[model samples]
Target: MDSLIFALNAVMPIVVMVAIGYAIKRAGFMNDTVTRAVNKMVFRFFLPAMLFLNIYEISDLADIQFGYIIYGAVATILMFLISLPLVILYTKHQDRRGPLLQSTFRSNNALIGVPLAEALCGSAGVVAAALLSAIVIPLYNVLAVISLSLFSGNGGRPNVKKMLMDILKNPLIQSIALALAILGVRVLFVKMDISFRLSDMTILFKVLRYLSNLATPMALLALGAQFEFSAIKELRREIIFGTAARTVVWPLISLGIAYFFFRDTFTAAQFAVLISIFATPVAVSSVPMTQEMGGDVGLAGQLVVWSTLISSLSIFFSCFILRLVGIFG
Candidate 1:
């Protein structure tokens, strides 16, 4: 019962916000164009602002839990490596091969992960998730490019140039860079015998705080607006395989290893970060990337919708398991 409450408390807010977005869209208050624009704003601007402020508030990088970063990076690469061959083995439809592979490895860590971190562990959890962004975001993007580029055109070689360019232009990476620059400036200020931190009165603080507060709600709303179910009947196989792999099989294996084998090594917050990595839904970005790269856009969208729909149950069960074992206090 305690674990159920904790899991529900952590997950329901996100689900409710998404429901509100769906309701608003169904009522015609916001159309596809408007909802899409909001999604873009949340991804490119609001979410980055949220991440920057979260990381920038940290006093020193030394205090960050590096194990969480390492754990997330390792888990991501393994998922990518393991899932690719398995997806190829399972599917004869090459159009869906890339999207299926992409969905298997790429979870919605930014929109869903950060909020989950905040819910379970508060500010400390946010910082752990933020630190993880530095390692996993770039890894996910590079792998996304690789996955799509490989099957984009008769399975030609991956475009390393495009991958590099995409990494450079990633808004999350850009935000992290800006935050690191700010951290450096803070260090310089310390050496110069001056003290400054973002305060409530400062315009930058006020603006960024407002934007940060909006990131999750806007993201969940945009997710709701984009949700679709009509294609489910046709793409049943992709939906089942993708949702199962993304939300169930992979998480169970990885989390079991982390819990039983590495229990003594990673902290509870670190375990929570791992949960975000392994438990969240397939990333929404996979849908657009699949379309742009000439894959099966229908299958990709279905994967996103179905995975997002059931990921909450996965997350709740994962949290319950961890709490039952006393991994979280």
Candidate 2:
């Protein structure tokens, strides 16, 4: 009952917040321009700040189990590979392949994973989810961008140099770098107290802390705002496939691998959190990435909405199943 309540408390409010975005947008309180601008602020500035602060606050990087991160990375790559086969064998729309794979495997770990973990498992879960985000962001972005651009018959291939440069410039990537740097310093000089004399560091800390706190609500709202009934109607097939792959197929695969292979190794909470991360739909921001890469933005948006709407069940069920298996019992 406690777990059920935790799930409801964490998920219900996020769903409502998203609905609020859609409602506000529909009511003309926030125009498209304003919506987009606010999203940028949230994404480029606020979200990165939040990630940096969370990662930086932890003095010990060595304790972060790289095994799980490696497991997640391998599973993500495997899912991507699985998509390639499906795209070639099943998908008739060659152009849709990139966007489909992107939605299917890449998760909204930062927006959905963190808050849900915090709600269900407290700060440790939040920190674990954050580490996953730090690993995933760059991998997902570069691969998705390149794949989408290549398949969409775009004018040219995505330049590797440009992509790397963009990754370097990305605020999330910057935060990850800073966080790792702090971790590195800590690991190198054990028991050494790290302090900063730079005035800029203090300002960055304050700004990031505030933004990090806002991340959960703002991201959920943005996710909700992007929901469109018309998009759902237009891209029904993509929506179904994307949502299924995200909220069901992906989590099942992750759980199977973690349980049967790494049985009794990962704690119940960790496994549950990982599966929950996989269960999350595509991020709200994937719309723009789709648009830029010649993929179908409408389809991406529809998938995000559909998958997110359905994920509560997937997460709850995964946890229930784990409990049955005596993992969480």
Candidate 3:
């Protein structure tokens, strides 16, 4: 009962926020243009600020467990590799293939996962999820660019050079890189016995905190506002497959492996990180990427909506079961 309540406490707020957003949209307070603008702001400014601050605030980088980091990266790549052939077999339409392949692995790690981690395991889990984000976000974007480009239906090959450029230009990746660079410099300052740090800039730090705080709520609202329910009949088959692959198959495989093999090795907080990575919904960004890359944008949107709705239950069960097994006390 305790674990059940704990899981509900963590998951319900997210569901409620999304529901509120959907309600606001239904009431005509927001429209397509507003939703797009909100999304762009969250992606370009708010989310990056949040990530940078989370990483920069970590007192000791050396204390972080690299094993989980490596596992996350490896697991992500494996998902991509395993998903490619499966998605190919599932769909012959090149445009559909790209979004479907992406749905299998890419998660809403930044907006949903970070906050969910904080909810599950407090500050420690947030740091774990943030660190994982530094690696996973870049990998997600790189693979997305490649997958979408490969199946773009352009009849020409993917432009490797452009893909590389896009990855470098990604704002999330850029923020993470900057945070790491600053962290390295802070280490050097420590060696020299310097006392000053970025956090000493009180006004700037507070401003950043404000921006960081806006990321999750505003992103959720935009996601809800953009959610549509009209295409279900037309895309039922693809939606069912993509949603199951994202919310069910991937989480069961990834979390099950972590539980059976690495349970004693990783802390409950670490397990929270795993749940955040694998059990979250498909990324809201996938919709835009699919559109930009000439994939079936409708399918991508539907997958995001359906997976998010289902992941509420999936994540709750994950937390409840893990807690029951003594992963959390």
Candidate 4:
């Protein structure tokens, strides 16, 4: 009950905000053009700012949990490889393949993971999720770029060089890379006993803070505006498969394996980090990425809606069960 309440407390505000967006759209305040512009801005600017701030704010390099970072990064890659074959086997619909493949492994970690982790383990869990994001979020963007490009199915073939360029040019990936580099420099400064701090740059940090604050809510509102209940029936098969992979199958396999095999090895907060990565919903970024990269935008949006709706229960059950088994202790 406690875990369930905590999960709800953490998740319901996002849900309600989404609902409000839906209501505004239904009332004709927003149109497709407006939604598209907002999504593009969110994708190109706000999301990247959010990713950068989260990664840059980590206190110290030596304080980071490299074991958890390696585990999380490796797990993300393995899941992408594993999902490629599974999605290929599941459907040959060119449109379905790309979105479904991405929905399987690319999570809403940037928006959803941190708060959920904090709910589960307070500040410790938040720290773990942040460090986890330093690795996992960039991996997600790279995989998203690759997956959408390969299965794009516009004609004869995708341009490999262009796809590679897209991956490198992705704002989110650029943000993560920049943040990592700066953090490394900061660490070196610490080693040399040089005075360096983010606070030294006040205006830039404030701008990033404002942009970061805009990212999640704008994305959620845009998601709400763009979501179509009618699209559910249109992409029922893809939606079901993607949502199930995100909200059920992955969590059970990953968390269950950790529970039985490495139970004593992970700290409680590390376990929470794992759950945040595994149990979170399909990303809102996928919808925009699909649009930008020429994939099934409708199916991608449907996947986000269903995945987000169902993931609340998935996360609750994961925490409940893990707590019951003493993982949260």
Per-residue lDDT tens digits for candidate 3, residues 1-329, read: 55456445555666677678889999999998887678778778887798787667767566879878888889999999999988888776777888888998999886667777787789888788878877788788788877887776665366778767867776766877888889889989998999878879999989989999998788767766766777678778788888998889999999999999999898878899988889888887776566556788778877877787788778888888898898987
Sort all candidates by TM-score, best to worst: 4, 3, 2, 1
Best by TM-score: 4
Q: What is candidate 2's local distance difference test score? A: 0.68
lDDT of each: 0.76, 0.68, 0.80, 0.85
Better of 2 and 3 by lDDT: 3
Best by lDDT: 4
TM-scores across all candidates? 0.81, 0.83, 0.85, 0.95
- Give the candidates in order of lDDT, highest first: 4, 3, 1, 2
Residue 188 lDDT, candidate 2, scale 0-100: 58
lDDT of 2 by residue, 247-274 (tens): 8888888887788988657765576568
Q: What TM-score, to 2 decimals, does candidate 3 have?
A: 0.85
Task: Write the number of the candidate with greater lDDT, choosing between 2 and 4.
Answer: 4
Clashing pairs in 4: none
Of 1 and 2, the candidate ranking higher by TM-score: 2
Residue ranges of candidate 4 with Cα displaced over 4 Å: 154-159
- Looking at candidate 3, what is the lDDT of residue 316? 81
Backbone collisions counted per model: 0, 1, 0, 0
lDDT of 1 by residue, 1-329 (tens): 65456556655666677678779889998887887678678767787787687668765456765765776788788988998888888887778888999998898886667777777778777777777866676577668767876777666456778767756776766787888788889888888999887673599898999999887677667767766667678778878999999999989988998888889988777788888889888876565556555778668767776787688788889888898898888
